[model samples]
Target chain A: MKRFTRSLGLTACAFLALCGQTQAADDIPTIRVGWSIPAEEMKYWMMRRPDAFPDLGKQYRIAWTQFQGTAPMVQAMLSDAIDCSSQAPLSLGQGAASGGLQAYVLAQHVGERKGESFSVYWAVAEDSPVRSVADLKGRTVGVNVYGSGVYGQMAMILKQNGLDPERDIRLVETGFPGSEAALRAGRVDAAVMNQPFALRAESKGGIRKLFSLTDLMPNTVHIFEVCRKDFTDAHPELVKRYVKDLRTAMALAREDRAETLKVVSEVTRAPVDLLDGYLLTDKDFARSADARPDFEAIQQMLDQYQQLGMLPAKVDVAQFRRDDLIQ
Target chain B: MSAQAILQRLGAPLTVLVLLTLWELAARALALDGFPTATESLAQLPAILFDGQSLQSIGASLARMFAGIGLALLVAVPAGLAMGRNPTLARMLNPLLSAAYPVPKAALMPMVMLWFGVGDLSKILVIFLGVSLPLLYHSYHGAARLDDKLLWSAAAMGMRAPARLLRITLPGALPEVLLGCRVGLAMALIVMISSEMIARQSGAGDLLFNALDMALYPDVYAMIVILAALGFALDWAFEHLRLRLVHWAEPRQDAASGGNS
Candidate 1:
């Protein structure tokens, strides 16, 4: 009888301890963050540098999810699988236009800054006779995706060079990994590339740049941070902390090049020497210091997509513009 | 076993060796940095297997795949058997199956993910969807081709409808059902890899694409080799089990030679 009573008392204590741990874990809310690329997203940096994001595991915990592209992120947000994510301007506009998901821009991550080297470059075989964008007529050009900012830039550049983008040149879909090889193998006459690919291709000594994203639109906002409006409304404090952490990450990348490159190398699994030449430097894509969204630049991108007939209808940027959460 | 049997047993390994030789030759001739040679690719295998994260990804992928196919077999076999026995049921479900046949299961990831979230449930559901159709199609034909007289004899005896199905119809359809399972096994692996590639959360497919994204050419080819070897091993094991289960049935032509009904 004495042994049975003692065993019951021990079981009760164990149960209470388990319940307390469960309640404590439940108390700390998780912010499900989504990112497509490694170096391009803040999550990769935030993961390695915990000191920069002091509130990360304290006020809120981060649950990281990697996506194939920003387009899939729209659906993920619609399902509430991701509370916040990195977004391209085109995806954000489409998500808002679809009416099922309401995502608000929190800050800009990648944009064109004046006097800095452009991140995206259109390159062709160095030995080829095609020296200019005009020479790309009747030839095939490879872009990452059909309705991406890169494709839009290519179309606008072709138009600027007096060639019909649709009727004159053939556009093929190629991913960044295969784009350089495709260009080299004569599968694509020209390939649009950004950092790593562009840098690697240049180092290979056979690819020449024709034009860049900066040459077409100097101040266009390429990628930015976004959160669901409902999520922001529900947990405004967590959102604010997240935005603050993002700015801190950006500042860390800008101020400390060597440390940033180490973290990037760990995340991207690319050699530090290969990335040292461009990543987070003046040659890299510009990030906003204050985590502010450039509404005008975003509007310009939306207008460009609309003019290209990529977007069916005009999206008013005002509806999705919310930067109040950024400290 | 005779010499002929020994030679037949050695055929698959010999074919793999020839293919690898050709790949090595072509890779050397092309001299493309993107395409790594077979030896270089195979060298990366030890690292993948030894790494904790890669092993976890592979383990999770296999678990989901097995779960998906197990669920598929449970539901699809019964429905297909019923449809085969009843002309009216077959007529009702044929249109739906036909409409879904041509649609790529991987393309349904976005819709499935929207409803189920990007979790194990969504991945398993997509694989289930992919494996089900092939199983249903084959199992239906298997049951349909059963000898009516055998079923009739069992029914004429003291057997009920369910008992006749169990004793007579099931045995008669065993060969066809096993063939369906073979096809469904391939579909399960296909859907599992492609779905993981699309979702990019965690899996062998994600591991493969992550290598591609990082420009780890050798790692990418290594992953392909691993997946290919995995597929080949699975098919070989299943074929052994199938032969044991349906040893009485006459040998069918090779699956690659379009022997499938």
Candidate 2:
């Protein structure tokens, strides 16, 4: 039996090797890019814009994957399925610790200091008499899945509002659109959300923002671009091109609001006017040079999160943030 | 039937009412954030019924779920029968099965994405992989449980080797096979959601994830309710088909007939 199994294994390995060799001939040092949002978002925003994604268009055929959240997108990069994807601050912190992947976060938000406040907002039904966080005690507050931006932001928001999340509000892991509906239906008291859903709720008089997490945790890193260490090592030039394209796209988005809004609205399926008012005008990502928060601050917050028994299976998150990507 | 009997006859609807009542109490008492009270969902059911995108998402999930289950059934039942009939082959594959017995089927999803790309194939394969196990095991055991006397009797009666094997062995195994089918059906729905939750950009799972992203608790519950219904409906269809075909073989059997469960 052992001999038979051994023979079978050898045959399978040899066949795989031969197939891989044939396929490798076509590999051409390809780079795969995973995106949390659809890739269409980038193309629509950049195609006509100046120098944005030109490098991307030239050398790399970005394989845009719409991951549910940043958690597994980081996992995918860590596992070597792709070169880069969206990274969560907490997940990035954990990923950096174990030293498997070097990842970094550049501010991925569309920063709009003047336009609209697209930074995270928490809200409930407009008619609900819950005026302050104190009234939210023992009420259900909705968030996206655990360990996600929504979860962390909501927790932080609650804490800042003088409401201890662990003590006062029962945060439920309700999805975003569902959370909006729940608020409308008077199911949840509040939810931590981003545009245009928040704007949608507010516009309909369906919901109202009680507080913004942005106000609570200023410079609280929302999202970042995470990359693999090995990929960066093998093709530094390609990674550079990827970042350059992202920056260029971000720059064009800042320079050309009208065009950017049209494209973004098409890509995200958000109405142009709503997106113009909320997303394009409100939250624009500024290019952080190092593409990361300081290691100590990042580490400290994550450690606090871990100590709170929020993290499962500790990781070397520091190592996951490849400084070279930002450098 | 009398009025009391008619009301009693409306038992299925009554069960649904009890379920709704339970859901409402739980949602309110628990102060469920982002989850709809049962009555609210019922009130908003019209929006779901009228919405094109919701229907499309539901349809997309159903297609992936059914296609995956169908593929699994096609492969597992026959292979299981083959293994069941051939003891030598079954023993030879035992180690292969046991090697990865405890590994979470969902963990291999990234590998599936690498191999299949982030397309329908990855989701389908995930569902297929999840459903295949109990099926292969149960059906193999079912085949083995067949009466050796029946096999000998058919052989003695001068039935052709293939015909004797097929007619006696397969029917004897059908009940166990149907049980495997039930297990596989339930598993397919679960893994389909999980796989879609992981890499899929559309489908009911994706819809649910999107709702979560937007913190739309009501839509999330709506999608979940839709998912649960899909599972129940699939299970019922399988049960119905199984009962129609195999109930005759139950104890006190006096006649041989071909029927759907």
Best by lDDT: 1
What 10-residue stretch in candidate 1 chain A is worst by lDDT?
A36-45
Interface RMSD, candidates in the order listed: 1.7, 4.5
Write model 1 residue lDDT over A1-327, tens digit each, in one string.
999999999999999999999899889988888876645646667877876777888788988777888888888998888898888888887777764568778877778787774557788898888898899889999998887877887788888899999999998998777889899889999988877777778777888888887787778787788999999999888888888888888878778888888887766556688778888777778776675888888888888888888777898888776656754
Give candidate 1 regions above 4 Å deviation.
A47-52, A98-100, A252-266, A271-273, B1-6, B156-158, B248-261
What TM-score is obtained by chain A of candidate 1? 0.92
DockQ category of candidate 2: acceptable
Model 1 residue A228 distance off true place after TM-score fit, in angstroms: 1.0
lDDT of 1 at B241: 97
Which one is best on DockQ? Answer: 1
What is candidate 1's lDDT per residue for B8-48, written digit by digit as tens? 99988899899999999999999887889999989999988
- Clashing residue pairs in candidate 1 (N, C-alpha, C atoms within 3 angstroms): none
For candidate 2, write residues A68-87 as lDDT tens digits.
Answer: 66666766766666677766
Alpha-carbon shift of residue A179 in model 2 (angstroms)? 3.6
